[model samples]
Target: MIQTFAFYLFAVFTIASGAITIMARNPVHSVLWLILAFFNAAGLMVLVGAEFIAMLLVIVYVGAVAVLFLFVVMMLDIDFAELRAGFIKNFPLGMALALVLLAELVLGIGAYRAGALELGVPDGTAMAPVGESNIEAIGALMYGRYLFLFEAAGIILLVAMVGAIVLTHRPRTDVRGQNIAKQIARRPDEATVNVKPEIGKGVSL
Candidate 1:
């Protein structure tokens, strides 16, 4: 009974937050709404016996993605009023797309309920050992079966990071930059001069 109530609570909050994420006029408020939706979605996952995925959703989406999104939105200098001025002009097209998506969602849900697709296909992988946690099971599958794919994903992300750095890194020619090679090559004799000055007199360089 408690599980059912919690499920409904999470579901309602998730849907409401999602709607507000789209409808909020302020982008920062939209991001906050998005974070709320993510949190409730994680609660739903926890209720469904997917605690591992729930924790991942909170850690990754809420901790990293949502915070990054909020920072980016706050930092950007955009004329949102000007951007929103065309909302009326685009409303018809946006409504048409929304209707199309709604129709597709309804059709998919109906098909799923009607058992239009066969779901249980057995792949030759060992089931989780008795008394082993779901997290351990998932780890086994990821490290044992999908290790190469996981490594490839890491490589792809690394490449993307390098690409972003290369694209955004601009060298400034307006100011002088430190020359490490020149500094390293300098000898004490070249950098300094032994000077003898008359007593109580200033020395000229």
Candidate 2:
């Protein structure tokens, strides 16, 4: 079926890109591969009937996060030799982390095979109302039950964005900057110099 073929295509690209992302020597190339992985992963999300998640994967991860990573990687002055040295030194730590992740994956798979864990008693309200679409249900729940939390998250992100802008902003003293007040306050006589210069001489600013 077309759906199966599309799923396989997305899965293959996602896995390949993820592997390349890690193996890439250049940080910028790695970021590019990571973006590719995010795109394919988003495609897979779409095939699985989770269009909302797919949208988030594309808009949030690929559009914002991956582009930010690419820009940061491009701007940074990195030393690959030093990075390799650090990687060698931290190889054991990395392996240990990988083992921990592997174990978590195995446990998760086992748990799923056994059946869904009884983590909580589900309330009937969690289910979408009849005749409502998935996105509509999600929107209703988000705006209805978690409105304050959503607003708080927005406020937090706004503050973080403002903080980043403030941190990166540098005041320049060497160049003349626009003075709106000074320009507005000036009269025509003060603003313009009506000088008759010698024919061969250039006028000074």
Backbone clashes, each candidate:
0, 0
> Clashing residue pairs, candidate 1?
none
lDDT of all the models against the reference? 0.93, 0.91
How do the residues 95-124 of candidate 2 rate in per-residue lDDT, one tens digit apiece? 999999999999998897888654577788
Q: Which 10-residue span in candidate 1 carries the lowest summed lDDT?
A: 117-126
Weakest 10 consecutive residues of candidate 2 by summed lDDT: 116-125
Considering every candidate listed, which one attains the maximal lDDT? 1
RMSD of each: 4.9, 3.3
Give one digit per residue, the lDDT tens place, for model 1 in 111-180: 9899995678767476787898889988998898999999999999999999999999999999999999
TM-score quality measure for candidate 2: 0.78
Q: After superposition, how far is residue 124 of candidate 2 from its true place, in Å?
A: 3.2
Estimate candidate 2's alpha-carbon lDDT, on a 0 to 1 scale.
0.91
Q: Provide the global lDDT of candidate 1 against the true structure.
A: 0.93
